[model samples]
Target: MSTADGPSDKNIGCAIYLHIPFCVSKCHYCDFASYAGKSHLLEPYLNALLTEIGSASVQENTRRIGSVYMGGGTPSTISPETAEKIMSAVAKKFNPSASSEKTIEANPESVTPERLAGYIKAGFNRLSIGVQSFNDRNLKSLGRAHDSQRALEAFDMARKAGFKNISVDLIYGIPGQTLSEFAEDISKAVSLAPEHISAYQLTVEEETPLWDMVEKGTVIMPEDTLLLEMFEKTVTSLSKAGYRHYEVSNFAKPGMECKHNLSYWLGEEFLGFGNGAHSFINSSRFANPDEPEDYIYEVDTAGRAGAEILGDEKDRVLEFLLMRLRLVGKKLTFKELDEKFFPFGRHDKHGPRPLFDETYRHPLDWISKNGLAEVNSDGFTLTHKGLLFLDDILLEFEKV
Candidate 1:
């Protein structure tokens, strides 16, 4: 075990996230805190990460760990030995139980049989491979290094190296991708029978090359109608293939959901390490510096980065609702919400409190009336139609 504590009501084991910020190449649409062409800084980054871990280790004695996830620009870009050292440090610092689900994210081109074996030997039990797309043209357009064939080979290599729990990532809505092409990608991914699958829509972020192309009319996005069709197709296809549509964009085999991600949605405590990694614990949410060099300097000088405490009740309530509502099957019960946020029942004298404030109440009522959601003593959940408009629904919360 990595830590000394046991799971409890208030502390149900924390999750640990390690951010590996190095990538072989940058994807045009990626906005995550990762750097390309920073190979030379790998050793220095790892050393700083180790220092942070050592400083945080004492807290682990009181916190049992439930999961460990290493995400990156691409964790596979680093050496297996480097990966192993990281796992060793985590194991020493956190003392997680034997059953803790340890996962490492890899891109198709960066994974090898030897790397997979090293991950397993280092105590990682789960692997998340980023395939992005199965179409070579789409891959090139997305700036992904691997072609469809390489993606298949990487999945095969992970399986051969004894990874029983695997997740495959796919993206849709590329400018040139047709509905039929996206369907074929889904079918091929299902055929792999991975324990989990994540299908994400392509969004153009402001600082990315995709955004510039879209702004300049050099690349046109798929019509909203077409994107909706693709989403519906994905849900229908994955369901028929025996994968549960667990979250909005995630599908998984029974009992095979990604626990680490679930923890985040469920508001569990987690500690994040490395540049730009975020943590939500002790009623505060904060992040490490986004720049690699800034992170190193901060940790070296102050032992930890500055964190923000989410102390406002209204802000907390909104954040909670936003995250929890993403889990389609898990609605927030009225009793739970009342006790945590409202405390007392709605009152006419004060013209309703923060939750029952007109700002939120009106939108929620409109949602229920429009058949976009259901509200009752049990709580609130999105209707199937509501899922399609989740982004708009979330906007309602933001107004409060």
Candidate 2:
């Protein structure tokens, strides 16, 4: 079994993210770039993914990759053999470090003991299962195909299949979900003792079926106060259970934080594969076509498509601040800022402008005064209180 050291230096190694955009059924609240009932396109899509990976290997001149994340509509929806083919192509094309985190996202319904073992044989060292909720009523409300029992069994199967590193995904604030239900979900997840856990507050996107239900008064979302209580409960319960609150919505046991995601938060470069996937490299972002057919056509005709360069320095600065602040305990430092945004040490007569300059001072002042964050000579870090209002705090920074 391969072992990875903690997060690698961003400058030394990059990561790869592959998208598997097929699902067994569409969840009511999902608006991601995934499709349901598209099983017919599976083989064609797999072939296209391999072709694209080969093409990328030729163009992406880089050092060893630190991580490989297989995310999706539900990556486990594909057969293990097909999934293994994609992993094989990746192994052939890119040099992944022995310590690299190779993770695949799975839904409980699609996960089986045989499939779990196959994934391990295919070289995936980590499993991130989307348990969502452990309550049957809550699962049904969210349109999850699996019941609470199936989710428990999925964890058992994964463990029996010899997966040592696992992560459980949970969601709070679902329609008609009570604080007690959310607490129970947290308790059960902690009992599983996965290496990592991510608890996200559900956000209803506009075009999803859940939104229509909301509009028609068929589903009522929990009030903000209730959501806040649930969020607090998550932090308290998880912390007491010995999970470190690493990111705003993520917790981990010791050195088990998701490296692929940590690379993103730290502004490290990553290459994305599959339909509707996005990549960030050298201050530019690239997106593939959302439609599988269009993505296949583009990959077949050209190497890739959709390149957007974030040429504005301010935009880069703001993005850096936003991503860095998502980290809970880490402080964003001046050296990190200078290296990324001012590699050549670009500055006026004052040597280098202070990162907390006049433009950022207003928000910084407000944040510091409110005890939401700590600003020092080197850099800043948000307190736990600040993380709760992260969106609002970031908005203040954005406005300036």
Which candidate ranks first by TM-score, i.e. highest? 2
Strongest candidate by lDDT: 2
Tens-digit per-residue lDDT, 57-146, candidate 1 = 465446878899999879998788988898888888788887888999999888889989998988899999999788999999998888
What TM-score number comes out for model 1?
Answer: 0.92
Candidate 1 to native Cα RMSD, angstroms: 4.5
lDDT of 2 by residue, 264-347 (tens): 887888888999888887667888888888887887788664456545777777877777788886777766776776665546
User: In model 2, how large is the Cα lDDT of residue 338?
Assistant: 69
What candidate 1 gets wrong by more than 4 Å, as runs, is: 1-12, 57-61, 309-311, 343-359
TM-score of each candidate structure, all chains considered together: 0.92, 0.93
| Candidate 2 colliding pairs | none
Query: Which ten-residue region of model 2 has the weakest summed lDDT?
Result: 1-10
